[model samples]
Target: MIVGLTGGIGSGKTTVLNFFKAFQNISVYIADEEAKNLMNSSPLLKSQLINAFGKELFVDNTLQRAYLSNLVFKDPKKLQILNEIVHPQVAKHFSEFVALNAHKAYILYENAILFETQNNQFCDCILTVSAPLEDRISRIIHRDQTTRRAVLDRMQHQFPEEKKRLQSNYLIQNTSLPALKEEVYRIHNILTL
Candidate 1:
């Protein structure tokens, strides 16, 4: 089985994903992290990014993520364009990863935009992690060290938590760490069985 795990910004997707990773029969693939790795390692992606944004976005062969985040987050269209470039490549990579891990009892495909990109179509089921709006905003502010306004701006680009929860096959509420871990383990058992 392929489980597509997703959440809005600061929804603790990584924390939940780590729990899923503990299962001996499950393999996890994180699209965002893989995309970051590819951005630097793949010459084709590098050229596309430089062409779409600019040469200066990469310094010393490294993608200047902070600068790009500042640029794209402020402009919705620019952020969409960036996603357009990265999401397809990430999707292709995900297919390969899943194929390679086909022998496993299940594989977790974790991507923030699973539904938006229709990546969930590849999964047997989809799980979304959710938190209160205030909690999510505060988490992003602390994690990204950005202003609350900036965090809200970024959140606006993501699918709303309530809507995503409705669309998901399963929802994990992440107010408490123990409860979150239990939710993950519970879901893992269901998926594996």
Candidate 2:
């Protein structure tokens, strides 16, 4: 089985991922990390990004992330274009990763934009991690050392919790670590059964 684990930024999805990581026979594909690497390494992605955002978007043949981020996040159209260029490559890489782990009992695909990209369609089930907005913002601030407004800006781009919750097969409230672990183990038991 394949499960898609997702939540908005700062929703503690990574914490849930860590719990899932503890389980044996499970392979985890972290789409964001993979995409970041691809963006920096793939010649095709490099050419496309430069075409979309200009050569200044790269420095020393590496992604000028700060420049590109300010450009994309400031314009919804630019962000969409960027996603269009990168998500397909990321999806292709994910397919390969999935094939490599097909022998496993199950695999987990963790992505912040699972719903947005419709990647959840590829999963047997979807798990959405959720937390109160204030708590999420605080967590992002503490973890990323990003300003509240910047965190909120990124969060606003993701699907709302209500919508994601409605689509999810499992909803894990991430307000507390102990409770979160219990919830994860419960879900693991259910899946294994």
Candidate 3:
């Protein structure tokens, strides 16, 4: 089963992913991390990004992540263009991952933009994690060392939390670690069974 896991920035999706990792029956794939790896490693992807953004996308042959983040967060078109450049490669890679993990009872594909990218179509079921807006803002500001304005800019590009909640098969309202873990375990049992 391909289980799509997604949430907005700073919603603790990574923490929930960790809890799911404790279950031996589940295999996990994190799309955003893989996208970064692809951007850094693939020469073809590198050229495409440079064409869309600029030569300064890389410095000393390494992706200038901070540069790209600042650029895309401020412009919706740039963000979409970046996604268009990266998502196809990630999707292809994810298909290979799914094939290798076909024996697993559940394949948890974690992506922040699953719904935004319409990747949910590939999922057997979708799980959306959510938190209060202020909590989310605070978490991202701390984790990314970014300002509230920047976080809000990125949030605007994502599908609305309310809409995601309505569409998802399961919802995790993340408020505390203990509660989050309990929910993850409960959902894991349900999926595996």
RMSD of each candidate relative to the true structure = 1.1, 1.2, 0.9
Off by over 4 Å in 3: none
Q: Against the true structure, what is each candidate's TM-score? A: 0.96, 0.95, 0.97
Q: Evaluated with lDDT, which candidate comes out highest? A: 3
lDDT of 3: 0.93
lDDT of 1 by residue, 1-193 (tens): 8888999989899899888877888799998899999898889899999998999889999999998898898887888888888888888888898889999998888989888777878888999999888988899889888898988887777877888888889999999999999999888888877
Q: What C-alpha lDDT values do all the predictions have? A: 0.88, 0.91, 0.93
Against the correct fold, how does model 1 do in TM-score?
A: 0.96
lDDT, model 3, position 131? 92
Descending-lDDT candidate ranking: 3, 2, 1
